[model samples]
Target: MIVEDSAVVRHLLAHLVSRDPRLELAAAVASAEEALAEIERVRPDVISMDIRLPGLDGLEATRRIMAEHPTPIVVIADAVEERGLRISMNALRAGALTVVEKPLGPGREGWEAVAEAICTQLFIMSQVPVIRQRGIGGMGAGPGRAASARAGVPPFSRPSMVGIAASTGGPPAIARVLGALPADFAAPILLVQHMGASFMEGFAAWLDGLVAPRVLIARDGMRPQPGQVHVAPGNRHLSLTPAGLLRVTDTPPVGGQRPAADVLFDSMARALGPRAMGILLTGMGEDGARGLVAINSAGGITLAEDETTAIVYGMPAAAVRLGGVSASLPLDGIGPRLLRAIGGTLEATGGQ
Candidate 1:
């Protein structure tokens, strides 16, 4: 289904969907209200939604759809303006799987390529399995949780920094983890989320609103501080120097990601050693597996989201298979676990 208000853009999207052999358009509606009302009948495997709509908007529609009928949704926006970018990010936070820029207008250079990109994204998103919106709470007690509590904050280590990596169904996952943290969270956090370049600024802004911690786009020479979360900018590899200052690199993409989680994890391992905490969240690839291994080998604590709660379970599962994860926890448990680890008391109860 395509939910876009503009007739021109809706026509373009419908044309692209029709041209793709792998996709079939279920419904093309002009407003979010119409899409919501007709969604049950349309029953699209995936939805292509525009952020700006006539009524209810894409973000609210996404939230409602995910709550009632979980389906993968990809938000589309012309991200040229800051408002559009912000709205796109809001859609993602509301459970849209990914955000893509709208196809350029006719006669613009590379318009065809842009349309193809959207088609490809739609196909990819359609393949993703999504779950209904459940509140952020520990799913259930498992052996992993017991073992994590028993380990009791690995001897003689104190976490100085936190590193997180995610993609695909990441925005909401990141929000859940970070939103659970207290405002006085002492360790600075570094996040690498694979997303389009146009969405970076707005993503950071959106995250700031969701979490208690101050969020900023990581910049070269900036020093990360406690109570702040630094997000790696799009298309740039964000790493930390030995002195703990931020380093944004234009180096070639590692594992096909410029802001690869591996790059950030390896750098954090080298810089903070046993004082670092590495977290691999829900994503679609193996980008963070090796980095989690590096952190584990360096004596840093490594955690991966457990399969039951993860949106895709690919990245975290890869790390678990590689023997890199120190503890695999559900989404809600991660924040509490991290706080305990940081406080040097990884007990079952609230030591942190």
Candidate 2:
């Protein structure tokens, strides 16, 4: 299923989805109201939603679906801006799972690769349990909500900053963890994800909607602050100094990426030491392994996302193998675990 106001885009997306043997078009609609009807009637396996629509916008529709039907949604939007970006980001926050910009065609932007990416995200998010948090009051119950209230985890406090890394299935995974955090979260989050340059700006803009913290692409020498997220640009390596300054470089790619997790992890180890908490989530490589080892050795907390929920399980699994991961946890537990880890409590989850 695809929801877009443009008839041409609807046709293009339908054709692209049909090309995949693993998927079939359930329906295509131009309005959110019509989309809701089609979704209930068809019970689609997945939905590719646009931020703009004829009547009810895509983001509002996403909120309604999540609050009601709770199905998997993947956002396909134009570039991020005030309203458009807000709509797309809100969709993710409302449990849309992932956000990707529209391809560069007249209808669907004509980018075949973008269509493939959307399909891949939908397929992957579908397999993961759609554990939507009803409200903060639901914490400490159910699998998804219980993870949020696990005892002995430390509450977030004043930490100079936080550093995180992910790859492959990173965007949605990162959003899930970040969305759970409170708006007043008292530390800046530095992020590294192996993604293309074409999408980095949009990615940051998209993230700003899902979390309370402001999200921006990192600028060299920027000082870390609470309630903000700095993302490593596609062609840059991001690091931190002992004094808490961001270091973004155009250095050669390490571990198959310019914004390699290893570089960020190692830098955090030297800079923040025990004050740091490193999180390794779903992905396709071992870039963060050694750096996590350094983090753990320096008394910082390290966490790996558990395989059962990961789209690829490569990076977090690799960090675990390196004997650096202090705890291995399911994706939903990551935010609460991080809060605990940063607060100086590290009870075993028996997860890995």
Candidate 3:
């Protein structure tokens, strides 16, 4: 279903959806109310949600939809508008799968890429299974706990940094894990989330609002402090200097990811060695699998989100197959388990 107030954009989106052989337009409505009303009847496998809508904005509509009838929703948002971007991120927090920049029109520059990304995200996200969530900012929907342990592997005594990577269903998953941390979390964190360059700042802003750590776009030469998160800037690979300061570089995209999780994990392997903790979360590809192995080779702690909780099990499963992970855990268990690891109390969970 397509929900938008502008008739032009609505028609444009409808055209885009109709032209794609992989997608079928269930319904096109001018308001979220109409979407809510017709959802059960039309029963789209996926929905392209407009963040700016006439009455019942996309955020609230997403919350209600997830609560009542669970379905994968991809948010279509204006990339540059502050209010619109905030709403877009909040819509993700409300259980929308991912956000894509909306195509203004065929004449607009870069309109082709935006349009393609929308259809692509829709097609890919539709395959993901989403469940009914209660209330807004849906939290604690973990599918219980599962852990894998390798025996005789000793835990770390003092970790200096945390590295995390995610793609696909990353935004909300990142929010859930980061929000669970205490304000005084002992280590600084480095995050690499695969998203469009235009949305990075707003993504960081939204993360800062939800997480205990103070989140900021990573900057070159800046030192990360405890209880803080440094997210790789768009189109830049984030790493750490031997001096423990941040390094944002434009050398080249590793495996086609500028802010590749591999870059961060590899840097941690070099800079912090055994004191680094590397986590690979839900993503569409294998960008972080080798990097997690690099950390494992350095004797650092490594974790991958288990299949029980990952929206897309690609990245984590890749790491597991490559023998890089030390533990595989459910979404809800990551925070407490990580805390225990940092607190020097966690036992081995085999993934080796």
Candidate 4:
């Protein structure tokens, strides 16, 4: 399904969906109401929706769809406009799976590449099965779990700090993982997302509403505390001090990211070592791979979202290929699994 107010953009998006052998357009409409109706009736595997529309708009439609259908939805928006960009991100928070900038047109030079990106996301979304098990699933008897146990990674001596890194379709992806955690969660979570300077604050705020943890933009020099979720601000690197202090830096972009995941993971390896639980979610680059290896070397437990659930498999796949990921679980398993990793019981866990 494609939902856009402009006739030209709608037609172009429909054309893009038609090009993929695995994807078929169920409907294309000008308003969110009609889009919602079509979704209720068609129950598509994926949706390419616009951020702005005649009624209800895309974000609201996405929120309602998630609350009702819980199907994967991809939002389409213009990249150049600030408001459009913000709304597109908000749509992600509303449970949309990914966001792709609308293509220029069939006549435009880069249209084929744009269409390819859309098809790729749709195919990925179609393949990810909804996660069912809570806490830890099977006792895989893998070396990873045995190593974590030997290191005393769980049942901590003190409050553990959580570190995560992501990019590309990270906003909604991370939210889905974190939203499963409780507000009074016993640990502190720090997130490093590869996004521009303008979007982090709003993203953090949007996540706070969805999760029990108090999500805040990380500040330099703050001491680690439980029940708080801190997100690395845009255009700055976030690292943990050996003293367990939150250190924010305007360092050179590592892996082409100012708020690079590698820097954060390296710092966690040095500071918290085996006491930290490091997670690498979905994204398009190899930003977190080396750092995850560092964390694994430090005896800390590391997890990567499995390829099945990732919006873009690049970052997590890199970590997996590097042999840094301790356990590769689906997105829905992350929150509950993290709780179990911290010694919480499966019966007590709950999240949408």
Ranking by lDDT: 3, 1, 4, 2
Q: Which segments of model 4 are wrong by more than 4 Å? A: 1-50, 60-90, 93-159, 344-352
Tens digit per residue, CA lDDT, model 3, 1-352 = 9988899999999999999999998899999999999999999999989998888999999999998999999999988999999999888767888898888899889888888989999999999888887543444535543345442334664576899999988888788788778766777889999988999999999889887778999899998877788999988999988899999999888987888999999999999999999999898889999999999989999989988778789999999899898888777667776777766222232211
Number of the top candidate by TM-score? 3
Worst-scoring 10-residue span by lDDT in model 4: 132-141
Q: After TM-score superposition, what is the CA distance of residue 15 in candidate 2 from its true location, in Å? A: 2.1
- For model 2, residues 1-352, the per-residue Cα lDDT tens digits are 7888888878878887787877788888888898888777888777888888877988789888877777778788776355686676556546676667676664445466677776776676565555443632233312422222345544322234577898755776788788767655667789998765656887787787667678999999999766678999877999998788999998888876788889998998888877777889887769898889988887777777877666567888788888887777777788876555444211222211
Model 3: C-alpha RMSD to truth?
4.4
Q: Rate the local accuracy (lDDT) of all candidates.
A: 0.85, 0.74, 0.85, 0.75
- Local lDDT at 218 for model 2: 95
Give one digit per residue, the lDDT tens place, for model 1 in 167-268: 887887898888778766778899999987767888898889878889999999999987789999988999989999999999999998989999999999
TM-score of each: 0.90, 0.71, 0.90, 0.66
All candidates: CA RMSD (Å): 3.5, 6.7, 4.4, 7.6
Clashes of 2: 5
Backbone clash count for every predicted candidate, in the order shown: 0, 5, 5, 1
lDDT of 4 by residue, 1-352 (tens): 7778899888877877787788888888888888777777887777778887877988888777777777777777776666777787777655676666678877687677677877787777765443322212222323332323343334433327789889866886687777777666767788998764655776676677777778899999998666788899978999999998999999789877889999999998899887777899988779999999998887787888777666678899899889997778777767777776664422333311
Runs of candidate 1 exceeding 4 Å displacement? 109-113, 135-151, 344-352
